[model samples]
Target: MPSEGEPHILAEIAERHARIGREQLALLRAIGRLDPEAPWVREGARDLPHLLAMRLGVSEWKARRWVAAARRLPELPGVAEALASGALSLDKVVELTRFATPRDEAGLIRWARHVSVWAIRRRGDLLERAPVREDRRAQRDRRAEWWFLQEERRFGLLAHLPAAEGAALAAAIERWAERVPAVPDEDGELPDLAARRADALVAMAQASLAAEDRADRPTVVVHTRLEPSGGPTPGAELERGPVLHPETARRLSCDARVQVVLEDGHGNALRVSPVRRFPPEWMLRQLRYRDRGCVFPGCGTTAFTVAHHLRHWSRGGPTELDNLALLCSFHHRLVHEDGWRLRRDGDVFAWLRPDGRPYRPGPPPPAPAGPPRPAPADRPRPALAAAAQARCAPGPAP
Candidate 1:
């Protein structure tokens, strides 16, 4: 809210400027059809150019461009339609109509709708550079492109690779599919190998990105609102992306990112903790060694497990080895969103319902023959041993 007497002049001027410019263009187009350069003796105007120069106070070059745009409108009616509809500007059409003709106007108009003016110029350059006669073999070669559009939440990919390259890609995906097989403690029916490979590919990309030190690396950040008596609205948003549902954001946070950022409602950072959202690698390794698998008793799933908060961060939960447990995505969601809850005692954790009904899984099946014993800790120092022996030695005087 603005304080009393505060003016929103900048916003008001910006809005009005756009409307006036569009209206001027529309009027110019209407007059362009009527033929501006009539040798009218009325009102002592020499001609349309003179009238425009003197009345509108525009330079001859800019006025000429606008006049040319009006003249060329008929030849590129598609671009003209967009201009009239206020979807495109006159300057853009003036430049685009230079490369595009009536024959290509339809396509250019569509491009103008989705792409920027600079992109239109780029396409023009590409078209100019294209060979007049394309090689038949090269034309037949496949292409690869991927897009994830945000508006409709749509994803698309088109791949055109040489046979050997295709085979190598397929083989790589197959190796991971065979290695991972399926997600442990899967909630519903499992997807096929193709789907699993797709997921594995995304996971591989994410892991690589997290390890990358390059600028523009992506991150997941969630903003939660402060308590009722305090500041900003509680909401979650993907960095540089759309607002996300709280549950979806929480699920993504399970990626175990090395950093967690806490923010106020106004999107100001309050604190940053590298080990808050994710435990350090050492802690995760310790967790894996101790928990062995999902702690949901009989569920003993070892693969595709994630560390979950015993006391959720939303309720002021702490992030530590003692406050965390390993569980697969299914069980994790159950513990977080569903009515099920978990109680942890050091390495052990158990699941229960709101009704106090405990669900403990049975003991895990026996391991395959003769697993190697884990290596032991280092030997004690000689001086420490001597001290222990002295403490144990009987005091004869006593």
Candidate 2:
């Protein structure tokens, strides 16, 4: 019960398949045993099959096979046929035989059809110029160091410890090593030398602290971005002091999108706005208490923190108190681009890991408990001493 049109369509498809097969076989045979590097071969065979197929609007794979077959032929009849049919060019077809194997030649031709001839030639040149035995030891060393740094990054507290402290610890270990006695048994066995050295240095530092008089510490710079909400109408004038840090001023000049509250000469609030767009100062104060610090899990960064809307502001998310969370640059990126999930319930915040597991944000484990305290001295001793003193001399209350 097939329609009459179906038979005609099937016949046309069969004829096309047959024509492509014949062309492929002819093209493959014609370009046999050509030098790959020769200008004619490079130009003609580089991507002839692919280019020819594209020109004919045929499949790249089909074009490759046709070019490969034409390359193997003693005469260029197949190549000529393809050129006549506008399937290939005489310049491109000549290089097809340069491939060591028919499979490689076919693949090259197919790729050529999809890609430009210039690209194929460039790739060939690059491949020819690539180093075979270059020294990679330095690269390997760098990779190892990179991996070590990545591991170190996971321990945030340790990562942030001053480099000077690390150097001092190393020096202490070296000094301790000089004082320790060497033993034949120690040759193959590792000792608890590092821990012993650390304990000795810690005790020495603590003793020094007890003897030295403490002095007033230097004031720390407060670098924070503020976002105020509510109160006065937008566009109120606020006085800001001169920029103390040139780098901070420069950064603000380039990308001053942080929200801040402006204060007048008398310390009265003026307005709130993104460092660029001025809003009322009272509004900025409203957001300060809600976002105490960066809301990102394990991030203590206060500077460069932004008030991010959990739901986008453009999508009808409110610019009010409840919808905003303070996030540093790194955490903001994680929430926006990286696949970290965040949820807030009442006052508590939860972070979900990449594997859909909840992250436990808690303090680090406490050090192991010390030995039990000694028993208290008996009260009878003090009482006996008091009695002796009373017997020696009766005294009135002072």
Q: What's the TM-score of every candidate structure?
A: 0.34, 0.25
lDDT of 2 at 216: 36
**Cα lDDT, all candidates:** 0.58, 0.43
Rate residue 304 of model 2 by lDDT.
59
Which numbered prediction scores highest in lDDT against the true structure?
Answer: 1
Angstrom error at residue 95, model 1: 67
RMSD value for candidate 1: 33.8
Name the regions of candidate 1 deviating beyond 4 angstroms.
1-218, 226-228, 231-235, 240-251, 258-277, 313-318, 345-347, 354-356, 361-398
Off by over 4 Å in 2: 1-281, 367-398
Scored by Cα lDDT, where does model 1 land?
0.58
**Per-residue alpha-carbon lDDT of model 2 for 125-224, expressed as tens digits?**
4564334332242232121011123655631111122335546766865776655554334476645665455455556667679999776332222132
lDDT of 1 by residue, 317-390 (tens): 77677887888665666665555778876546666864568764333233324422323323222232222222
